[model samples]
Target: MSKRIAGPEIERLIQLLAKVPGLGPRSARRAALQLIKKKEQLLSPLAAAMAEAVDAVRICSNCGNVDTCDPCTVCTDPRRDGATIIVVEDVADLWALERAGAMNARYHVLGGTLSPLDGIGPDELNIKALIDRVAGGGVSELILAVNATVEGQTTAHYITDQLSGLEVRVTRLAHGVPVGGELDYLDEGTLSAALKSRTAF
Candidate 1:
């Protein structure tokens, strides 16, 4: 009879699990214990799903969204307003905007924002692709929905500069106070933007 297995295999699994975001050694240990308790119900299915996703998931060539299909559902959907495209940083942000159910326009995922310090420039991102999409015509407005970080703002400004000569309307998300922040702790940028965007106040 073969001797029982322990130590190395469990340690390897825990180490690999710890590499995932928000999961440290403690959480990985707990998760491994749970998986051991219900291997058939959780571990097997989880492994299968991860394998399937690895094989099937791909970035959409048109908009940079991740999907099993090439164009992704949003790009393939006919009802979405193709003439109005919302430019975002990543697929997660795109999904967040979609979940809001307020934006009727299509999307262009930039993959990431411009961060010169990090050596991520326009060429590294999907800025050229976005410009090409605009140049192809039929697009009436391009909404800059990148995050409020410094890199995000820089990327947005770069995009705005690129489309300056193009015959399309460009807009940005109105920056302002958070719904829950105390008025005294607000930053200068937020206060200025909020004041500039104020209406009938």
Candidate 2:
């Protein structure tokens, strides 16, 4: 067997890093070594940033978006359109939408989708908070930007049913083939959605 090379502290760091989403033990070890090699430039700054995030990270009470502030920058930003809100499945999705810069609307992070098998329900998500926000009025459109997965669609349907009595118009993010995607490579769902949502040139 290959003998353990790292000290206890370094080994611990690798183990912790391996637990990160896309990192594995080998990658973590490489990362740890790199961090140690560039301690002053990378390690110190990363550590400080992590510490600051740990101390300040919070969920926005109004929209469930994660940020350092209670209301979050998106919720409080005057530039965003208060009349339009995009409902997303996760904070990551919210960030993705923001990076796209397609619209200047606010967002509501659902936290997660409804999954009975996984013991996740409407109560577990930020659905109630979203309903309350919509109930407050002035929202002209509620865009459901959840994923096209089974759980995501189920959650979308449930939310649509819930808002049946509300006067606001609910919309969904259009799912179709990628800009340069070939029809042969697309799934049945994608093909169906693309055909249904086809627009005139």
Candidate 3:
């Protein structure tokens, strides 16, 4: 091991920071140095915020959304169209949809898509919760806004199979979405168009 200049504690923090997406060892080191330089203004508050988030944020019971409260703001909102629910793979997808401002329906985060080779099955995701939501009966449409990847299509088909006997209409994002592209990376206009032109799967 190279000489540990940061000491075990700070080195541990750097390692943990590096584990976050879009961050690497060098970025983490730079971040750690910046934090140490502004310990009182940045590091302390950041640590406190992280602790508070870790303690308070949890998966919404109804939709699998991470929120400070159960049911989440969207699920509990009276103004949202309860008759339509968009099914997405993660909170980031949900955020993307919201950012587009085209979807007035509530969302159900699947947590992940079906991946047999990765050993991730339907049961591992929030499929059961989605079924329950559909079964409760107010939803008239389910828009499958999952990614266009192979696993995403598989998961969408799985959801369609699950909802086959139900009265609710099931639709999918339009073909404009590029294969293997995540919704989070798409621009607002493209996402809006996809939502507007969604077709039956």
Q: List, in order, the clash count of every candidate structure.
A: 0, 0, 0
Model 3: residues with Cα > 4 Å off, grouped in runs: 177-201
- What does each candidate score in C-alpha RMSD? 3.4, 1.2, 5.7
lDDT string for model 2 (28-103, tens) is: 9889999999999999999999999999999899999999999999999998899999999999999898898999
Better of 1 and 2 by lDDT: 2
- Residue 75 lDDT, candidate 3, scale 0-100: 90
Best by TM-score: 2
lDDT of 3 by residue, 1-201 (tens): 377665788889888989989989899988988998999999999999999999999789999998999989999999999999999999999999999899789999999999989899988999998998999998999999999788998999999999888889999877657768899999887788778878899
User: Which pairs clash (backbone N, Cα, C closer than 3 Å) in model 1?
Assistant: none
**Candidate 2 runs further than 4 Å off:** none
Off by over 4 Å in 1: 1-5
- The Cα error of candidate 3 at residue 83, in Å, is 0.7
Model 1, 97-142: lDDT tens digits are: 9898998889999999888888998999988989999999999999
Q: What is the lDDT, from 0 to 100, of the residue 124 in candidate 1? A: 95
lDDT of 3 at 74: 92
lDDT for each of the candidates? 0.91, 0.93, 0.91
Model 3 per-residue lDDT at 25: 89
Ranking by lDDT: 2, 3, 1
